[model samples]
Target: MKRARLAWAIAGTLLFAALAVAAEEGKPKEKRKGPRLNPIAETMLRIDRIKAAVEGLDLNQEQQDKLAAIRDGFEAKRQAIQDKIGDLLTDEQRRIGQEKLEELKQGGALGREAYQKLEEALKLTDEQKQKMEPLGKELQELVGATLKQVMQVLTPEQREKVQQKLGMGKKGGKKGEKKKEQ
Candidate 1:
């Protein structure tokens, strides 16, 4: 009887492990993070990429000075926004924040039109666009992968607690969703 019970326990453990591997395989990819770039910042980055890609299009001293000035001004404005958010946002600000973020990404105030203007002003080219797109994509993927790896080092129970705190652990999902395999 003891031997039979041991066999059942081993089988249960194996099944649990198999379920974990299956769930990991089924998991969707996560979004990446970096220096949180606004639409304007992203547009500026694309412009810089184009300038770097085109040979002999390097900025002269005056143009370089102007670019530096523009970047400094943008940085100052960003800092001010961060400072203002503390006084402006209330306890019920998360929904509004999400809406505003979506609006910005959409056509709220800074979207395709702004991108177009920057592209034209910077004389962006197809080759530069191709190069920059891949770089940005790769950077995002790298960040995601790094996050996954760090999370993997945590025990299943530890991961569950962290995810729950972060409000990401799903409810009523698969039984093994938060359970650690043997």
Candidate 2:
């Protein structure tokens, strides 16, 4: 009887151990972080915001084609700036920059804080910072011109829709701000 009891105990222990092992094996493996993005570019953030603002607008085929043409025309200039930025960053720096941008985007940092985040992420040597300064200026100009061209293509109603989506108004306050009493 003792032998029988001992055998059952051993069998139950083995079964429990086997079940535990099988449960672990059945779970999906945790994914390991992969290679970093090739280049981390903040230029995309502004471009993306503009696109998000207008993506759902009801534009005719003609308007769509016109906007597409403008974007295509600007592509070469944008790509040149991107290439220069890519040349300036090392792989590790790109990875760090990506992490920083993701953090800032998630945090919804804007204006001064956004600029500070980029400055922090760039983390370049003085010489590299100097080289980046002009590229940064050029990128800002390109983005501004692109935005202006894009806006001009939209009808007034469509422009208002885009502006509201972008959280701006004629008053230049964000979409939600308390008006000052006269």
Candidate 3:
């Protein structure tokens, strides 16, 4: 819980920095540009870690195929969300746009469906779930560490620029934007 919380904090801070950067631009550019990784990217990285571990397991072809399908299914769903975010929201709205992005990250209706499918496919035994719990927690910490490292490497102005691009500051909010309920 501590690790997940820390990771989320770092990710949120990084996103805030991106939003600040975007605000610096005299006008909202069609897209805010900056060096940052969103939570979605971090989640995908954790999924990849899971995939790698699962791949090393001595499972039968059926298990392998099913797991691959599970991974692909979630990846595709994530990609779809990313595509929608880019097209649907304005550049300013996209920055500081943590609420909706987090909603998508937490998984919406589509996410629940995908998770159900993954549970079916992985056939995770109680033991497996227990083992995976710690791994998942560790992955969250690693993501947080990475975000911190990235933030440390960048300048304050650069950080703010990234935040602006993300619509995180006063200059970045849109009129119609609403906090997406998880």
Candidate 4:
């Protein structure tokens, strides 16, 4: 009788453990957090950073006025690019963009390569590329102009410090590393 009770107790404990494991398995997984910022938001954040960095340069009144104008132009160009992208997207395209953005957030080279392959396969028409190219160029020009104007306002020593702050030099920054790899 004693042996039988002991066996029953052991069996009950084992069954309880199994049920606990099963219960855990049946629960839904927690969802991952989405991207913190979209592309436009990221660009704006960079612009803000540039503005902050320029504030430390101690520009003269004329240079300050020019920098302000450059910043204004940059903002306007950024908005135009945003509007153009929005106008170009259809519902289906927006869905695809969301999926791509999620994939990017996941941080896998395979995902990026797959996206590149998809773009190559699609082979956008010449007309479409032509239409998009100017918007891209305009955005780049605005950003570059802003940077140039800011650099103009700074002394050589200050410029060097700013570049260091931006991680722009040859001490194994992202661009430098990429160039080395190539």
Candidate 5:
């Protein structure tokens, strides 16, 4: 009777161990969340926002075509700059940049001097800085042009709404102040 009980206990223990292993193996792995958008994904999301804002504004086909063209052109320029920057970054720099980007995504503010901090942190070479400067300027130009084109596509009322939505209007005044007022 003692041997039978021992055998049964051993069998039960083995079964329980197998069940625990199976349960662990069958469990779903948690998905990792990263940056809200990669560079290219960000450009596409921006374009989508423009589209959503302009919807129901009764734009003619030609104006819509122009907007599409402008978006596509800007996206290409943005992608090229992103690729260039990615190429220039070392693996370690990329890791740091990604962490910074994630922080920005999480509603963290980067101060005006953030670029200098980034430069120091990345230890960017003069040659890399030179290459980055023009690309940065080009990106700024593309953004301005894209905004102009989007505004042109919108009516006066829609433009105001867009400005407000983009936090360029009075309602967007001094981030914390707006929240406080509300």
Candidate 6:
């Protein structure tokens, strides 16, 4: 039950993000004039958006149960990778990481500043970042797949509700932008 709850929270984060990336696949990429957003910062924003979108829905018991079941297979793998990454951190770094992670979990509005704050707090050694990179990447892929499965459990109407909350409609544009243009 605890695992399921955790999965649901994680699903709230990753699902819409995966769908959004999937939605943007064919568009010509736009280059920004300034420094680009870090992938971690972009992900954190997506997590907030997706989590809120899912929370706004009226999900049923069956949907909840299905999400829990889907999460069971992925949780252990995710945790193991997390543990392995934790093993690489120094004691002090781990302490700071825990504190920062908790603060982020509590929903403070850091924006892209969240990444900068973490980077400053950790002062992660090059060697540590090098070792954790692959594990981090693998964790991301696993979570993305888990999120996709969670979305599959939703009915089309429920899915649309989530997308709309994320400012994404059936055609993958901002929720009402197309209608406004037409």
Which number leads on lDDT?
6
By TM-score, who's the top model here? Answer: 6
- Candidate ordering by TM-score (highest first): 6, 2, 5, 4, 3, 1
Give the winner by TM-score: 1 or 6: 6
In candidate 2, position 123 carries an lDDT of 59
lDDT of 5 by residue, 76-182 (tens): 67566566656766788666755554444355433222322333345555565555555544554566677787787766877777666454544423334332211
Predicted candidate 4 versus true structure: per-residue lDDT over 18-126, tens digit per residue:
1112222223433423323222223333454566677777677887788778766765666566556445545664455445434543554222243342233333344
Q: Write the per-residue lDDT of candidate 6 for residues 143-176, one digit (tens) a residue.
A: 5676577678888888877666755547544324
Better of 4 and 6 by TM-score: 6
Runs off by more than 4 Å, candidate 3: 1-42, 45-116, 161-182
lDDT of 4 at 8: 43
lDDT of each structure?
A: 0.36, 0.55, 0.39, 0.47, 0.49, 0.56
Encode model 2's per-residue lDDT on 40-158: one tens digit a residue: 12334455568788788998898899998887777668656556755666787667655665566578764334544554555566555545556655755776788778888889988
Which 10 consecutive positions of candidate 3 have the poorest summed lDDT?
A: 16-25
Every model: Cα RMSD to truth: 25.9, 21.8, 20.4, 22.0, 21.1, 7.6
Candidate 4, number of clashes: 0
- Weakest 10 consecutive residues, lDDT, candidate 1? 15-24
**Position 169, candidate 4: lDDT:** 56
Residue 138 lDDT in candidate 4: 56
Q: What digit string (tens of lDDT, one per residue) describes model 1 on residues 1-182?
A: 98976544433222222111222222343442432332223333333332233222334565456545554554454334333322333444324433433443355433233333222333323443333343334333433343344335444654455455433335412334643323
User: Candidate 5's C-alpha lDDT?
Assistant: 0.49
TM-score of each: 0.24, 0.54, 0.30, 0.44, 0.45, 0.62
- lDDT (Cα, tens digit) per residue for candidate 3, span 88-163: 3345444435444454456642222332222233232344344333333343454445434433434566444433
Candidate 5 lDDT for residue 134: 52
What is the Cα-based lDDT of residue 94 in candidate 1?
Answer: 29
- Scored against the true structure, residue 108 in model 2 reaches a CA lDDT of 78
